[model samples]
Target: MNKDIYFEDVNIGDSIPTLVKEPVTKLQFVKYAGASGDFNPLHTDDDIGKMAGIGGVIAHGMLIMGFVGQAVTNWIPKKNLKKLNVRFAGMTKPGDTISVTGKVVDKNAENNIITCEVFAKDQNEQVKIQGSFEAKLPKKN
Candidate 1:
């Protein structure tokens, strides 16, 4: 079970625990396609990808966003999240190692909310997705 993160325990600039995912794989993409019902060829068909201009199959943007979401919920319980958003900045291909990191950017003690700036980057430090989130936290007694 996830413990409640008290608002008093977090400070601006505090780093959230990082979540590093294993390298992207074709099988994962296929599974994601089935699970999401997004049968886009660019995500599951390499030959189609080559024809479309991208060199090979690319992972779905939502899949990468899911990774970012995991990073947030890992630190803040799912029920606490009030807002979560991301922008896809780059394509993620098979073999790319994704690392998600975040830092506390703002905290409203009166509102019991914490805002964070979060991003996902590949092995080369190329950002694939960037976003922010707000979560309600308990107050320490």
Candidate 2:
């Protein structure tokens, strides 16, 4: 899908298209917990979440990070990417819509790599994840 992107075709400040994800829910948290082997009650039990200071169960921060990763990979093929990192900044509730976006931050031609900065936001425009990505672009003939 990213066959169109070549090393010489991208530049700093170029905006990658946005990727939208479905809302988070309790079931999703439970499933993710089981899938990831992370059974932290704070992410699946409302009572424990409230007692921990957060009013309700919060989605796993890694899940939001995954969404951001999905955005970058969606724009550029997987093997093209070499590095990606995300920081969970805000809590996501059941009804929140997550949108992931990124921009070309720098190009490292000597190493055949391009760097990108990414973030995930909710419907309120509040940033939920702050992240960065680095990728290897195909060389031009």
Candidate 3:
């Protein structure tokens, strides 16, 4: 694990470490479905996905969002995260590699809080998720 980031350690506009994940896979979809209890056929069954007119199976949006969350927690501890908001912008299919990145957009020393703008994009540069998060970091004594 990385050392804890204090409130004074980061500056507005600083870039967080980028997180690039392996290509989405059918087995991963199945595992995510089992863990999230979302057995929507579109995520696991190609036939159902075709029937839904999505061409083929698409990954769960929440799974992509989880990737975004992972990027944030990679930079700061999980306990520091106070708020996370995201919107699904595009579908992610099996075989698509997703990359999550963020920039620190705001910082509040009074509350030791920092806000970041975050995004997840496919290898083709298509946006899959857009979001923001707030983290209250510890202050140096």
Candidate 4:
């Protein structure tokens, strides 16, 4: 995919390929609950979710973050990863189409790190996470 984006192939203004994920649902919330060992009622019980002042069973923030992380790793590959950081900003409801996007913000060939600004947006164009990532790409010849 994308010829493995070598250090010599990208620039600060280059747009990273955007990845759109399927709409989030209760079933996915359940699966993520089991996989992460975080069966919080707020994520599974519609009643509990409402009582907590949130809409029915909001999606887990971690799960959404993971989706964004997947988009970056899938694009650049694991060998290039150096660091990733994100801040949760909004909640996602069922049936929302989550989109993950990123852009190459800076690149350092001497240290082999490519910095990118990453974000996950919902159907309403609301940001879920404001994040940044750094990956060490294959060195230029």
Candidate 5:
């Protein structure tokens, strides 16, 4: 929302600003559970996670998706987002640092829309989520 990004200024391979999230933490999972009403013990209780054979508590997929959403909205205004979709690719554990990135994949000059391929990867280069989005940008005057 800082400035309008005109469609004419962006190329098919242009990179969007990256968003880096703080390390994942137990407290964040608890907070997300409270906010999202996803009280699944696998995300909140280590013992339950261990019992379920996951080794330890895992971060909620939706929470990671929220991080990806933040990345999208940080580059384009939320109101201009026409489509945003993601596939949960892997589990995120506490202390994992996530970075969200995107590249322009396609565009529609007539409709002023830009399509982007987006993803969230950890410090170790493990992909946690992969997705794409479409946003409407202003036409150059």
Candidate 6:
């Protein structure tokens, strides 16, 4: 669960707690597709994915991004988030266990803004997404 974090309590280079998610599954993809309205066969149909030369059905990039978001929020509250950006690095396939990790990269005491660099990688250490986020944290009195 995310707890309130103060700007003074964090420092540049400090590591955020890691979030390891269970292996990806087709069922989860289906649910995500329904919720996201993506309905892209490449993410839900093995045959179409294979035909597209991606081997087989792969998890949606946004789903993996959501995992990264979860990791960030696990460290700080969503209300504090100011900016988030990500680049899709690799495909996430079924049975791939993803682990999201991050570290504080910069901090501005005047603005109470903290910047963090984060990445989501599979069990093999294959990077699925890379990103950074900025959050305005409260300063302890």
Worst 10 residues of 3 by lDDT: 1-10
lDDT for 104 (candidate 4): 91
Q: Write the per-residue lDDT of candidate 6 for residues 56-116, one digit (tens) a residue.
A: 9999999999999898888899999999999999999999999999999999978999999
**Candidate 3 lDDT by residue in tens digits, 7-101:** 99899999999999999999999999999999998999999999999999999999999899888888889988999999999999999999999
lDDT of 4 by residue, 1-141 (tens): 535678888789787788899999999999999999998889999999889888689899999999987898788887778899999999988998999999999988688788999999998899998899998888657
Could you tally the backbone clashes for each prediction?
0, 0, 0, 0, 0, 0
Pick out the ten consecutive residues of candidate 2 with the lowest summed lDDT. Answer: 1-10
| Structural similarity to truth (TM-score) of each candidate | 0.97, 0.94, 0.97, 0.95, 0.97, 0.97
lDDT of 1 at 136: 92
Per-candidate Cα lDDT values, in order, are: 0.94, 0.88, 0.94, 0.89, 0.94, 0.95
lDDT of 5 by residue, 1-141 (tens): 657778888899999999999999999999999999999999999999999998999999999999989988888888889999999999999999999999999999889999999999999999999999999998768
Q: Candidate 1 has which clashing residue pairs, if any?
A: none
Candidate 5 has a TM-score of: 0.97
RMSD, every candidate, angstroms = 0.8, 1.2, 0.7, 1.2, 0.9, 0.8
Candidate 6 wrong stretches, greater than 4 Å: none
Q: What's model 5's lDDT at 139?
A: 79
The TM-score of candidate 1 is 0.97
Evaluated at residue 10, the lDDT of candidate 6 is 95
**At residue 20, what lDDT does model 2 achieve?**
86
Model 1: per-residue lDDT, tens digit, 92-138? 99999999999999999789999999999999999999999999998
lDDT of 2 at 27: 92
Weakest ten-residue segment in model 5 by summed lDDT:
1-10
